[model samples]
Target chain A: MKVRQVSIFLENRSGRLAGVLSEVAKAGVNIRALSLADTSDFGILRLIVDNVDAGVKALKDSGHTVSLTEVLAVEISDRPGGLAETLEALSAADLNVEYMYAFVCRVTEKAVVVFRFEDVDAALAALKAADISVLPANTVYAI
Target chain B: MFNPQAEAMPREELRKLQGERLRSLVARAYERVAFYRAKMDAQGVRPEDIRGIEDIVKLPFTEKSEFRDQYPFGMFAVPMSEIVRIHASSGTTGKPTVVGYTRADIDNWAECAARSLGCGGATAEDTVQVAYGYGLFTGGLGMHYGAEKLGAAALPMSAGNTEKQVMLMKDFGVTVLCCTPSYALQIAEVAEQMGEDVRSFPLKAGFFGAEPWTQGMREHIEERLPLKALDIYGLSEVAGPGVANECLEQDGLHVFEDHFYPEIIDPETGASLPDGEKGELVFTCLTKEGVPLIRYRTRDITLLMNSGPCACGRTSRKMARLMGRTDDMLIIRGINVFPSQVENVLVRIEGVHPQYLIIVDRKGNLDTIEIQVEVTEDLFSDEVKKLEALRDKIHYQIKAMLNVSAKITLVEPKTIERGLGKAKRVLDRRQRI
Candidate 1:
């Protein structure tokens, strides 16, 4: 299963991140989980939003650099060894994760982790064989 | 003084000598150099018309682009058999401006340099280090031969290798340091880093040139190195680094009117400006044999001082330190960089927009350049590594073209401001210092 994620390029200037957030809010898009990866000159704002298409459109219309990335949303137990077990399974199958971020779903008491993998197909097959539940695109959007 | 007779010649005698040299130089150029002949013919003037320095206004002015038009050796007045040396300007994009020097021309250059060193109070017992780049660039060899001509031990340090530069400066007990003003400051910084006191060295004076530096920078270098910081001005097209130099008076650089005649003209109208009025500095080679130029327009902006006797006993006219350039050319660490050159490199690369901005700054004691290029839609990848690769590609291309390192930044499309009129391409924050 694949999840749609929205990513926007942000220059390392004052109030740029807030400007992107205000644009997303004006479009009535709710961001569920987010992560900011930064360097000295610029940063990338990655968001797992409820409305991916609307968020991307709003950011682009605001003259922001935006892109859509297909990632995996895996549901894991909300326990101490949850991430460790899932990573062990991917390592056993020789799959690599480029980057990953996590958020807890309070109602279900489960951790929802967003992962970007180099070999998505192989990673999906490995998770499927390892019996870890991969959330569907619609399920990730609803969460 | 190196040549007291020429340096301190009376105003009437100096003017008489300049007038005679100007007449002979104009006639030689009109007869041998086709470019000068065509320019003079188009201006409805003849060699006979320029009878003296007072009639120099009738001669046509030469622009830097004329050198590019002539390419490698098209402008040389003498044949290859008589040419002894050649130096070129670091042209970033197209063909470089080439200059040729005959044996006697080189000797005259050395003489000018010797006089320049003498202005800094250097003597035959002094150890001089020439830190300008040697090959192709006129800075290094120009100072090297000048030091030797002055009977001083010339150390051809030739720019870069900061560690070695500092070590030799201390070990050799260098008395005269000839380099770009910025590099002189860099050397002081490196010496400090090595836990060595620059003041403890035998450095008595320095001849700084090949770039426009401010009085504040002069104060910084002098204080740090604890030596007299003298300003020397020259360009490769006009006999290189010995055209003018600051005598110990440190007021303005004294132009060597005996060899290279100086003039100031309005940049826009090309009309001659009065003395003490700021305008573009133009030079006419009075005695160069290989490639004598007639009224060459040096785009550098400065004013002429009154022709009078100086406390240093020199009666030659002086030119104030350069204020600014009339063109968009940027001199980063003694190397010429134009915005169009960077655009040339960007347009040739795939998935890069022509729109760009050049940001030049002085970090610590060195100059740095950062170029921001807009990324096209096709090139903007979600992965940061891909964008970094694109930046690296642009960086390598620029380095290969300009022979200087730059930090290339990939910005989003439409992020760099666009102007309705002439685009603002350069953000130079270094000039403030």
Candidate 2:
């Protein structure tokens, strides 16, 4: 299943994060699990949100770039072997993950996972073959 | 805000301040540097007659040839042991012109560079990435010391290796960049190609110098980088990159009057022009201990402005935008060309960029000129007729303005390439060294 994610481009400065947070709050978007990527010139704020559309709109309205993508959000166990098993399955299927992140899966005691792979079909097939369930598109997007 | 005290100082006070420093430096020059003393003796310059800065016009002008004649360490005013750092400019016609700095000279250099950066809106809070090729050229180290003096975190990210430069820019978060205007444009192009927005850079501004750039080029850089593009005016001979700098207001570059005294004079007659007159730019290093020059003729074409006071509040004298050169014109064909003229035309040609190559070739003693212009998507995708028409328009404009008729060839966009250090726009393939 695909999870739509939002990435906001920001200059590295004090109070920038505050502006992003303010916009998100005003749009009523819940940032489920977030990650910050940076370079010398700018910072990229990547988030898996409860409402991707609202989050994207909020960032775009604030003059920040919003990139939306269909990504795989697999449900992994909290145990040590969980992540290793998923990674091994993808490797066995000759698939690679371009980027990935972890999120809190409320319905399961296990960890909810979010990932972006260049080849989504191959990755999904590998997960299915390993008998690991990838969450449905709706459930993952509303995370 | 601009400080009005110095610019508003009584003309008599400014004269007196310069006179005192001139007397000391001249006396020191006459005593230490044999070349300087001999040059003065040849011109019959007497110590008591050295009255003031006005008398500086009466003194001999130190040409680059004099430095070449003396070669290595002939221009230094202090002992060799006291010199802390050395820098040299490559010889265009002869031996390399070398400049040295005593410990005190280095300190003054740092202060001048710091002041220039401050004028260009760099603050202690900014992380400065200095990318002016560091080595003997002096541009890189010059900015590095100045950024350090300003108490800013300086990234000594020297020239070339564009990929690494871009990577660092994204990783380290540099806010203020010091480089040539041409290189800044090149970086902006690279960033755009990487699917990154040039405006997304943490950079608030840049101090661009090294080679002559036109106002049109400045506006282009501002449009692409969307930041203040301030001109950094200096030469390796005169303390490098800190002799003057344009503030964010972009009115005129404020010369550091207290340290270096400036004058504009006719290149042919050696007659000094009044304020607001166009002439060759000359400088006298009042506080420079290593190589103190008296009326060092810079050969650059510019104007001087005493125009009331600047918005930045600096009390120093202001210099008008540099147009070109009194000497060393960028000659293409039999007609002489100035880089600024090419820049003026290039900016108006729409799709053509300041990134261009001028090739001057010789065939059986006859000179042939050709311009290699980059073709951006805006120009390349146009019908062949449109592209050819655009090229003809540029050719006609350059010929009309500079009186030089040359062949113009269109290369793929970003293909002529972008340079992030000193922009090498001319290649005289006719002459092989």
Candidate 3:
């Protein structure tokens, strides 16, 4: 129903994002999925890591500002109109998706899209009512 | 209450006394200091030309660079034998501005500092904690002597050692806290971290000076520590921390006009501006014998509050809190910008901390300013659009207020350097022509 996403603030300078990723890598934490939201001056690198505590500690030890966000990861069909169908259900429920990113699963014909909604619990209940498959925290980390 | 007679003197009588002091100061400067004599001769204005305080404009304005060029003891009116004490303030460039004090000068400074403390409601029963750094800097000793002269218990605690400072405040029952406003904030933070309620302490008033602080910061300190935060203004070149201070009314700082004559002048043309007009501040040491400066340009930007006498019954004129310094003003795209204006906008906005850094640079044909704002945990959002919206809001407000387009950069919390003495606000990287 919810996944813990690690968000690191990266200044728009060369090697800043690389430095952040390397900090987590030095702690032997595996990154499952990641998305970068950027502007001309700065960027926010959001990641779904296998070991949340280890990754956070590594980043913190390296003096990087890291934030933990609870986002919903839902499984949709890989075919076209899959996202549009899920979005239509969400629109019917009036759940607002603040921002979202996705990653494909090689094991199944489904794709996991991470969504940051205004209300996590409300979004979770809406997806459940719409019969959408919501991936659990453990499943997202393992995938 | 030390020296009530002088503090509350009638305006006309004060003016008369100021005129007499100015005449003596000019005569002494002309006879003793070669610098003053040469400057006066070049302007064709003799010592007799300045018969009253009204004729102060006849005196040549002394720039800060002149003090540095004179160096060690060239500006001293008295010989080294009569100079009992020496203090120097660091200049922006070159040699530090050195000042000497005779025994009378020290006593006068102490009297002024005592009067300043009295403005904040200090008395013989109060214990003052001087947390401003001691030695070389004038803040610590300046306030310490004032506390002593006021018949209050003086605590020379100098700066740093936060936990101990709080403990001493609790144990020794310090009634008055003296330090920069930022340092007071740091003390409050340390007290809270130690699980000690500073408001429960017996602090009645605080004298915060040496740097310009906003009204918001004053409220923050007062709310946290339960003390009347008063602004104390001074410069080592004239006399340290006791030059002027805000009385209990908290309207404006009452300048000790008899000791230091205050005047406002247009920084551009060096023409005298009337009271209540915003301009550069120039000070003339009226009775300073050791180092008598005649019409020394301070370069601080402020307006003289022309309102009637304060409610506290002091007839002395009050000066508005400093807006900014002339040197601190940055010209970007043919517009003058002050860091205080940027700070004014930042404090009014929600989710934005007052701590920020302004970086100015030249990009080819135009000047560029980049404002780096710290993103607090409460302001941080997972959505990129929300963060960008925050940046845009800051950009729009700055553009609307300052009329200068700025690049707003959101950085992580605590990334900008914070100086305990005076927080560094501006960084100019432009190539000097």
Best by TM-score: 1
| Native-to-model Cα distance after best TM-score fit, residue B39 in candidate 3, in Å | 0.7
* Model 1, native contacts kept: 0.20
Question: Which ten residues in a row are the worst by lDDT in model 3 chain A?
Answer: A103-112
Query: Which lDDT tens digits does candidate 3 get at residues B1-433?
Result: 5787898899999999999999999999999999999999999999888888999999999998898798989999888999999998643243779999999999999999999999999999999999987887789999999999999999999988989999999999889999987778888988999999888998999999876566877887898998999999998999899999999999889999999999999999999999999999999989999999888888889989999879998889999998877787675643447788888788777835557999998563246899999876556776778888888999999998886789998887667998999889999886432
TM-score of each: 0.92, 0.58, 0.62
The deviation in Å at residue B46 for candidate 1 is 2.5
Sort candidate 1 into its docking category: acceptable
What ranking of all candidate models by lDDT puts the best one first? 1, 3, 2
RMSD of each: 2.7, 21.2, 16.5
A92-135, model 2: which lDDT tens digit per residue? 88887776778676767669777777778888888999998898
Worst 10 residues of 1 chain B by lDDT: B374-383
- In terms of DockQ, the best-performing candidate is 1
- Tens digits of per-residue lDDT, candidate 2, B1-433, equal 2223544466678779989999898888888989887888888876667888778876888987787787888888887888889887644343668888998888888888888888877878888889888887778898999999889898998866766777788788888888876678777878777877668777788898776566777787888886789988888889888889998888889898878999999999999999899999999999888888778888888889969777776777889877666654553321345565677788877844546787777543235678877654344421234456777888998777665677887553343545788676776665421
lDDT of 3 by residue, A1-143 (tens): 68999998887889988899899989999999999998887889999999999999998888777889999999999888999989999999998988899999877858989999889999999999999999989989999
- Go through the candidates in order and give each one's DockQ: 0.37, 0.01, 0.29
| Model 3 alpha-carbon drift over 4 Å, by segment | A1-143, B329-433
The candidate maximizing lDDT is 1
